[model samples]
Target: MNLYWHRRDLRGTDNRGLARAVSVSEGPVAPVFVFDPTVLEHAAPVRVACLLEALEGLRAWYRERGSDLLVVRGEASDAIPRLAAEYEADAVVWADDYSGLARERDRAVTAALEDDGVACESVHDSIHHEPGSITPNEGAHYSVFSYFWKKWRDREKREPLEPPAADALADVAGDPLPSRSELGFDKPTATPQSVTQAAARERTTEFCSGPIYRYADNRDKPAVDGTSRLSVHLKWGTIGIRKVYAATQRAAERATTDDDRESVAAFQRQLAWREFYAHVLAFNPETVTENFSGYEHPIPWRNDPDELAAWKAGETGYPIVDAGMRQLQAEGWIHNRVRMLVASFLTKDLLIDWREGYDWFRRNLADHETANDVGGWQWAGSTGTDAQPYFRVFNPMKQGREYDPDADYIREYIPELEGVPADAIHDWHDLDPDRRAQLAPSYPAPIVDHGERREGAIAAFEQARGE
Candidate 1:
């Protein structure tokens, strides 16, 4: 018998690692999941809630297969090996996780299992390609995405494997799944759009059907349902990365227009970006806390408590930034463009440390991936590899007017801006005092002048870089 451990990969469908465990097992395979308290402490309330919901669905899936997802609560290093010994399993199989914490835990678990004479098998199922698989001639990973993208596109992707069917099963009764209260987290008021594999599959089909055709033109616009809201699903492994890639390929093959094909390719590039960040994280694990670029030393940061509080409360007085923050609070998600804008505003415009924004997002974003969040925050803050130039500051007002041209996105999240005219929404501060008062009386004034802050940020960057 073999033990199949579930981590982020929650689903039974197209799970290569799970398939591998069943294929190689001499008898029935015991599927197990452990909820580690240490890990839960780092997860946000919304993330924990979403994870539990997904696990509930996964448990049902396992039951339908005449087996159970043996649930446990403890450190995985201890829980997994103990379970292996209890079941007398010959091998423990699981998908490899690339996060810093996961890597450390895996090492400890592997060492413990080795001492017990149980073999451990791992499969790279979450990402299309294994992290660190693609690399430059001289380096272990690519810092620039363009270089990574070219190699990524040229490499053949693995076809998703079918889920394993176990004829026999472990006879042990599973522990009852824990609740949010039991996990020391409240059930968040806001959660993910869906938590089941069925929902993720339906979304993938629907997106590939038509939305992908127009993705290029509409993806950056925040007001419409233009982009695939699949990050959370991907993060939780409700759907496999290869399945999404295959769906995109099918969409491309069926495309009648060049634009459609281009859009499909564009969306696939985003998948590459996801892997790109993962690769960076795998090679430079220290980037999680240290700046990837190594140029953040002696940098000046305002770190104003009032400004940070305002930013967190979505009262920055910049409509776009406020709207994004409010959206994050309300839905536990935000648009990609708005994410960059908000990060830029915090790190550059507000002169705050990027780590502050990174930590906040880590605790707030329902779709949080350590690598992607770190990559994005560092990119926006100009402290990451191949990051944006530090001297370049994002003008939140211009971004608001540009991406959310009709101001619908702003109005959707910030009620105070609802009555403001579309023409005046992005420049509400520039309006006549009487009209500004009449339109958005409750809205606060700009927290910091963008023009002055932009110069200050540039000067600080110059000093940090010793210009």
Candidate 2:
């Protein structure tokens, strides 16, 4: 018997590891998912809830095929071997994961299995291109995105594999599925709807049929539902990157004009950004906590608890920043443009460390991947590879007017501003004193003067650079 361990790759279809295992196993094959305590202890409630939903879906799918999924909770290194011994399984197969902790856990598990003479195999299933596969012609990794993406475009991606046959594993015993509350975590009564392979395919089809052609022009506007909204699905492996890549290529091929094709191409390039950050994380794990370039820039952060609380509570008095923060708190997601704006306000304008904002997002975002979260925060703080220059600060009011000209998004999140006119919405100070009091009685004034904060940030950056 062989065991196929599910981790990030939650779906059974187009799963490279499960496919390979089913092809090679002669005896009964069992699918398993281990809710490792090491991971669970740190996971946010929403993430834990989402994982449970995915696991339930997988279990139902497997039950229909006469096999069952074995769900367990323990250290994966010990759990895999113990489960193997119990089932007398000959080998274990799984998708290769790229996070530092995941890599270390896999190493320990593989070593223990090897010592016990149980064969363990890992297959690449998560990323479109394996890390370090598309390096520069000089055999070194490219630091910039354009060169790497150009090379990424030329490389051939392997066609997605089919789902494993159910008959391949007929005699395996399945364990009872556990609920979120059973694991000592409160199940969310109202959670974001889970994304399955079918759902993802529908979304991809819908996008390609219409919105994809307008993606380049519409993506930055938060008021419009322009983005793929598939980040969480991608993070959990409900949809394979290869599948997305192939669908996007097809869209580009069928596009009626060069501009439409270019839109699809641009959207595809964002996927490259996702992979590029993952590769960077694999090469420089320290970037998870520190700057990649080893620059020790001292930032003078404020210790104002009330100000921090205001920022967290979405009462920062900056319309754009407050809208983004509130959106994240309520929806477990924020638009990409708003993400940049809020991050810039927290780190650059408010003079708080980016790590604070990063941690806040990690606790709240349903789509939070460590690589993307860290990359985004550092990019906004001007401490990451190919980051925006430190001096290039975003003006919140101006950004609000540009991205959400009519203040629709702001009004949706910041109800206190509902009565404010569109022209004066971005600049709350423009309201007459009596009207401002009547419209937003409880709204706090802007926490920091933008001009002074901008100068402070610039001077701090100059000092750090030895100017």
Candidate 3:
């Protein structure tokens, strides 16, 4: 018998790891999922909530096929071996995870399985190409994304694998899943959307049907529901990467014009970006906490308790930045453009350390993937590969005016600005004290002067670079 261990890959459909387990098994394959405390040690309420939901969906999928996903809680090294012995499985297989902590746990689990004489394998099922597969002539991975995107775009991707046939699955019943409260987690503040295989397929079809054609044009406009809203699915692996890529390929074939084709390509480029960061994090795991690129001198970041508090509370007095933070609180998700904006507001404008932003995102974001979260925060702080240029500190006012032009997105999240005019909200910084008070007495004024802070942030980076 063979054991298929579930990690991030929750769905039964289009799962590479599960297919591999079925292919190698002489007898029926038994599926299992271990809630390793080592992994949960870093999880937040939002993440736990999504995990439980996905697990429930996966369990239902297995049960329908005359099998069950055995859900157990303990350190994987112990629980997996114990389950393997009990199930009498000779081999175990799972999908690979690239985070440093995940890798550490996998190493321990592999050693224990080996000691017990259980054959084990881990397949790269998350991203299209595994780490170190796409590389520059000199380095292990591309530091610049454009270079990586070129190769990733051209690579021949594998077709999505079918779910294991019912006869291939062992008819094993599993224990009841634990509730969030039983798992020692409070109900999440932000209510995330459903993360299930059905939901993933529905979203992909709905998005690729029409929205993708206008993606490049409307993606920057937060007011429009232009994005696929599939990040949570990808993060949880409710949908397979090949399934997503295949959907896009179908969308491309359905396109009627050059513009539509280019728009589809634009969205595909983002997929490439996701893999690029995974490759980077795989090679340099320390980049999760430290800067990917170093400077001659240390970056001089400020530490102001009140400012940090305001930023977290979504009261930063920057309409757009506050809107993004509040959106995160309300939804456990933020638009990609706003994510960069808020990160910039914290690191460059307030001059706080990027780690503060990273920590908060890791805790608050339901869709947070370690590689993407660290990459984004470091990029905003100008300490990552293809980091935002030091001289181009984001002007929150211009951003508000350009992206949220009518301030519709701002009003949707920040009710305090619901009555305020879009023009007044965008030009809040330029408005004098009396005008600001008259416009919105409840909402605070700009926390820091953007013009001054932008120059200060640039000077700090220049000093760090010894320029």
Candidate 4:
């Protein structure tokens, strides 16, 4: 008997590891999902809720196929081997997961299973190319994105494996799925609570069919929903990257104009960025907790409780920054452009450590990934590999005017700014104190002076580099 362990890859369709496990199984194949406490211990409420919904969907899927999903709650090393013993399983198969504590846990479980004489197998199902597969001609990993992307495009992608036939697992002992509360996690009350594989598919189809062509033109505007909105799905492996890549390729081929092709290409490049960061993480796992370039510098970060509270509550008095923070709190997600802006405001403007923002995002964002979140925060702080230049600072007011010229995004999240004129919306400080108070009575004053903070950030980076 063979066991297929579900981790991030929750869906049944087009699942690389699951399909492979079914294909090689000689007897009844059991599908298992472990509510590993080690992983869930740190998961935020929203992420916990989304994971429960996905597992519920997977349970129904296995049931309809006349098989069962065995859910174990404990340390994976104990749970997986215990389950394997129950089934007298010859081998255990699973999708390979990358870093964070999950990777370490997997390693420990694999070692334990191998020691117990159970064959353990892993398949790459997360990203298109394995981390070490693509490298420079000199046999070193490519640190630059464009060069990696060029090679990424040239490589032939593997055809997505078909979903296993129903006959693959006609009979197996099934287990019940657990609720978030059952696992000692609170249920999230957010817009993404209803997310499922079917919903994810619909979202993918809708974006690819219509909005994708104009993605490059409008992706920066948070007021407009121009993005794929599939990051959560991708992060959790609810959908396959190959499937999305194939769909994009097909759309590109059907394009009647060069502009359309370029749009598709641009979207595809973002996908490459996803993999690029993953590769970086694979090469240097320490990047999760330290500077990617090994730059060691002492930063005199403010641990001001009031400033941190203001930033988190979206009372920073900067409309763009506040909108991004509020949106993240309300929906457990934020736009890509705003993600950069807010991260910059936190790390650069407030002079807080990037780790603070990183940890917060890891707790809140439903689509959070270790590699992507770390890459983003460090890039904003200019301390990461292939990061933005240290001296370059993003002016929040300018970024708002450039991306959200009409103040539509600001109004959506910062309702107090609704009556403020578009011209003055980006610079509330210019208004007289009494008039500004009348317009946004509930909004707090800007927590930090941007001009001074910019200079401080530059000096801090220079000092760090010298160290």
Candidate 5:
């Protein structure tokens, strides 16, 4: 029997690693998942909650097939080799994970398995294209996304693999899965929507059915449920990338109008972006901590504890920024546009280190993926490849008026402004102290002058660049 080491790919259906295990196994494949303390150390409450839920869903799937997912707790190096000997497995198989720490873990596991005389196989199951598969002619990966996107779009994608047959799985039973508390994690402050494969599949079908057609128009408008909320699923590996892309293709085929077709393409573009960051991270793992495009001089980020705390508490008095931050606290997710805006606000307006924002999001977001999280923070901080230029700081007021025009998205999260007029809400930063008090006395005034900060941010960037 071959032992299938389940990592992020929690789902049985459309899993490449499981299929590979079955293919090579002489008998039914044994499956195991190790909750290593090393990995859990980097995890937060929200992500741990989601992980437990995803594991439960996976366990249910295995139980239905007369097999059980092995839930073990130990260092993978020790646990995996021991399991291989216990199961008397000839080989171990797993899906590829793209992060420096993950890569380190894999190396340790591989060495231990080899010492036990067991072979190993790791497949590229998560993303459609492997890191080195899509890249520039010279560099290991493309620094600019557009150049990468064109090649990624044109590259032929692989078909989604079918789940292993029930007969192909080992009939060994596993102990009852542990709860979040059992794993020493507190209850998540903000919970994510159901993160099972069922939820993911249903969401994909519903999104591709009609919402995809209006995605381009409604994606920027946070009030509308325009974009597919598939990030958490993708992060947890509840759904496969091939399946996501296939859904978009079907959506495009159903489109009757040019605009509808374009909308589908727009959503697909986001998928490409996800992969683009993955490739970039694979080649440049240090970019996670260090700037991808570093300046000659270090960025003079302000060490203002009060300002940072206010931003974290959604009390910075920037209405739109506050709403986005509050939405993260409430739902464990924020709209994509709002994510950029809040990130820009933190890195520019407050001049705080991007690492602070990245760490906060890492702990709070249920869908936090290392590559995407770091890439986005650096992009907003103007320290990433193909990122927004340093000179173009986002205007929170203009952004609020344009994206949340009716203040619907803002009001949905920030209830203090629920009764305030849309105009007054958008102009909250500009409103005088007495006028603001009269409108929404509960809400605080703007913490900093955005106009002054924008100019200051630009000058700071120029100084760092030595220009």
Candidate 6:
């Protein structure tokens, strides 16, 4: 018998590892998922709840085919080997994960399985390409995204695997799935609308069918529904990256005009960016804590608890910044452009450490991912490889006026600013004293002068870099 272990790749459809397990097995394949406490304890509550929802979906899918997902809870090393021995399984297969902790866990499980005479196989199903597959002439990982993107675009991506047939699964009785509270988390009442594979497929189809034609022009606008909104699904592996990439490629081919083609290309580039960050994380695992550039000098961070508190509360007095923060709290996700802006404000404007913001995001984001989160934070803090230059501070006021010119995104989250005029919302603090007084008392003024803080932040970076 063959055993297939499910990790982040929760979906039954187009799963490479499951297909491989079925292909190699002379007998039925027993699909199992173990809720590893070591990984779950450090995970975000919302994300854990989402994973449970996905698992329930997968369980239902398996049951419809007269099979069941063998759900277990404990250390994977012990549980997997025990389950394998009980089932008399000779081979175990699973999708590969690139994170440091995941790699370590896999090593332990693999060693234990080998000791029991069980072969372990890992399929790189989650990402379009494995980390080391695409590289420079030196055969090392590409630290620069442009070089990586060039190679990535030229490489051919394999077609997504078909879902396993009904007879492929073993008719094995399984334990009941656990609830959020049972897993040591508060019960999450609602599954976000975009949690399931059906929703993800529908969204991807809708995007490639229509919205993708305008993605180049509209993706950065926070108020517009221009994005694919597939990140959450991608995070949980509800939809395979291959399916999304294939769909977008088809869209690009079907393009009737140059503008349409440009839009499709732009959207595809975002996918490349996702892979790029994953590649960065795979190579520089220590980037989770240390700066990627290895700037040894200490950056003098502020000890203003009130400032940090206000930033987290979405009352930073910057409309754009507050709007993004509020969205994160309300929906467990935020716009990508606003994410960069908010990260800049935290590290540069507030003089707080990037790790602080990274922690908050790790705890709250429904799509929380360690690699992407670290890459983003380090980029904003100007400490990553190919980071945003430290001197080029993001002016929040300009950002609000530029991207959210109508102040629609701000008003949507910050209700207090709803009544304020679009122009005034972006510069409420700079208005005449009478005009400022006329605004609601509930709305606070800017926490710090941008011009003053800009110089101070630049000086701090220079000092740290020994310029």
> Per-prediction RMSD in angstroms?
1.2, 1.8, 0.8, 1.6, 0.7, 1.4
Indicate the residue-level lDDT of 241 in model 5. 89
Candidate 3 lDDT by residue in tens digits, 1-467: 99999999999989999999999999999999988878887899999999999999999999999999998999999999999999889899999999999998899999999999999999999999999999999989999999999999999999998888999999999999988888888999999999988999999999999999999998898888999999999999999999999999999999999999999999999999899999999999999989999999999988688899999999988999999999999999999999999999999899999999999999999999999999999999999999998778999999999999999999999887878899999998899989988878888988889999999999998999999
lDDT of 6 by residue, 259-324 (tens): 999999888888888888888888888889888885547887784789899899898889899999
lDDT of 4 by residue, 69-146 (tens): 888888999999998998898889998877857678989899989988998889998899988899988744678888
Q: What is the lDDT of residue 210 in candidate 3?
A: 96
Q: Which window of ten consecutive residues has the lowest lDDT sum in model 4?
A: 186-195
* Tens-place lDDT digits, model 1, residues 385-459: 789898889888888888999999999999988767888888875767677778889988887889999999999
Those runs of model 2 whose alpha carbons end farther than 4 Å from true positions after fitting are: 137-140, 187-190, 429-433
lDDT of 5: 0.93
Per-prediction TM-score to the true structure, in the order listed? 0.98, 0.95, 0.99, 0.97, 0.99, 0.97
Cα shift from native, residue 371, model 6 (Å): 1.4
| Candidate 2 residue-wise lDDT, 1-467, digit = tens | 89999998878877888888887787868999998888777677777777777777777778888888898889999999999998888899999887788898999999999999999999888887878887877644666878888978778887867777778875566677677777777654225556566667788788877899999999999999898988888888887887878888888889999999999988988888888888888777777788765445566666467777888898888888998888887777899999999999888888787888888888778788988898899889888878878899999989999999999999998888877787777777455657667778877678787878988887877777777
Give the winner by TM-score: 2 or 4.
Answer: 4
- Writing each residue's lDDT as its tens digit, candidate 5 over 146-257 gives 9998999999988878888899999998888778888889988896888999999999999999999999999999998888999999999999888999989989999999
TM-score result, candidate 5: 0.99
The true-versus-predicted C-alpha distance at residue 74 of model 2, in Å, is 0.5
Least well predicted 10-residue stretch by lDDT in candidate 1: 164-173
Please say which candidate is ahead in TM-score: 5 or 6: 5
Clashing pairs in 3: none
Cα error, residue 200 of model 3, in Å, equals 0.7
